[model samples]
Target: MSITKSYSRPLDFKNGRIEMSYGAGGRAMAQLITDLFAAAFDNPYLAQGNDGALLPMATGRLVMSTDSHVVSPLFFAGGDIGCLSVHGTINDVAMMGAQPLYLSAAFILEEGFRFADLKRIVDSMAKAAFDAGVPIVTGDTKVVEQGKGDGVFITTTAVGVVRDGITLSGDRAQPGDKILLSGTIGDHGMAVLSQREGLSFDAPIVSDTAALHALVAAMLDCGASLRVLRDPTRGGLATTLNEIAKQSGVGMLLNESSIPINQPVEAACEFLGLDPLYVANEGKLVAICAAEDAERLLDVMRAHPQAKEAAMIGEVREDAHGFVQMTTKMGGRRIVDWLAGEQLPRIC
Candidate 1:
């Protein structure tokens, strides 16, 4: 029998709050899973009600990535913690040049959290997975005591497959390779900061949290000699580039003027005394490819809606010190060092 059908009373989603019983491995927990999570993320695999999902194996190299979302103020300008969790893990798999297939989510809900909010987050997560052609096949839930946890925290893991002959990694970059950015940087971080601090601006900044697998697929179809595909997330563009440089044992020369930044994001960073380069992003990506294929790759990236403003921001170079140097907009040279400390905490 279906778990939900076994329950005599329906959950009070409209005017209810989470309780410890919801995660106590009893009737309440089963009912919560069946009525809420299962109803929202309906899929054959999830319907099995098994301890773990049974997935059909696919041909190609498999890729798996997991991410935890704890962004303050669960809801933001363009997205919330739910969709952000989905996109974050999917982007991680896509960055490996994989086709994401399924997702597993685990939630930690604080006691006293409103059931209405939880439903919203789960529904949003389900929609994101559906739109991305991925399914949330299995998951677990736990409730913590109030004040012991945030309202809610979501951790998602995604699985994908990458066909043979497509090898992308951070260490594949070489001197003379071109570096490309998918779009404007720092949108997500600034958006969250503004909302958290209740700071209002004439032009509000929205988070660029989005699924990027389609963009990666388009780039692959263009047949460019791609080396690395990384979404600049927590550490933003500068830190991401530095990671690649260290992994590939190379240096980078970036054109500061060429990097894309929305006017509102730039203004907010200036006001907050934050550097956009070190700010976080959710939707944008950084690509490193052969210099000869730079233009071809750029064309394909720009063609995608997610990367319409893509640009070649820098180039890999030979440097024993593995430094990332940028030519300023005023024609000055400066070293774009690694982020010294945590710039924004709980920034997703």
Candidate 2:
């Protein structure tokens, strides 16, 4: 008989708040996992109920990365905690020019989290992992008292293989390299903001959350000499570029009009006193490559479904101060400084 055969009870989610007993390693916690987590995230590996997963490793340079998701509202415009958790870590591993293989997720749930809602999140996550051709090989779960935990928090760790001859990093960008943005900016931030404040607008502001490994693979196939790869996340494109510029001892010059932003996102930033350049993004990425390869790289990016709106936003420059400046729509220039304060915390 299966070890979990005797474990059968519908989890009490209605009117039940998280208590210390839920986190305790006993019948209560076991029941919670058997009913809620194990049921929703069912998979051959997960169903095995082992402490860890044993698997085969691919031959090549190995790359691994981990990220934790705690985005507010749990569910949002484009995606929820489930898909975001998978995308965030997958992108991290892919940024290193790796093909992500396996994933492990750990969940921290607050007592009283609705079973229906939790199911939605887990199902979304499992589907993402499946679609990405990756598996959630192992996981752990813990329940905290109602007040002590958020609705849910997920930490995902991914392992992948780095394709030979494909090297990537932030410091690899060089002077005269071209900078390409995956697509429009600030979609993720505006979506979260709208939902948080109960605000509505004429044009819908959606988050640009997506998996980018396929896009990166396309670039590699196009023979582009990619020097660096970085996803513009919490601090947005401006911050990510600044970090790269400083690391590479170079400067950046951006064409304001060339960068793309959705109409609603632009208006929302104007109303909220935020800059789309500095707002958080989930689905966009920054690729720096040799100037000669810029056009070819752009061609590859534009051909991909995720990067159909790709644009060459800027170029690496020689600056003594390692500054990042932009040519505004008015034809005047302004220094794009590092973000001084948190624009939107808990965005990722």
Question: Each prediction's Cα lDDT score?
Answer: 0.94, 0.86
Which of the numbered candidates is closest to the native, going by highest TM-score? 1
Per-residue lDDT tens digits of candidate 2, residues 210-291? 8888888888788889999989988898999999999998999999999999999999999989998899888889999999
Clashes by residue pair, model 2? 18-111
Task: Extract clashing residue pairs from model 1.
Answer: none
Deviation in angstroms for 266 in model 1?
Answer: 0.4
TM-score of each: 0.97, 0.94
Candidate 1 per-residue lDDT over residues 1-348, each given as its tens digit: 665634358889899999999999999999999999999999999999999999998999999999999989899899999999999999999999999999999999999999999999999999999999999999999999999889999999999999998999999999999999999999999999888856645458899999999999999988999999999999899899999999999999999999999999999999889999999999999999999999999999888899999999999999999999999999999999999988988889
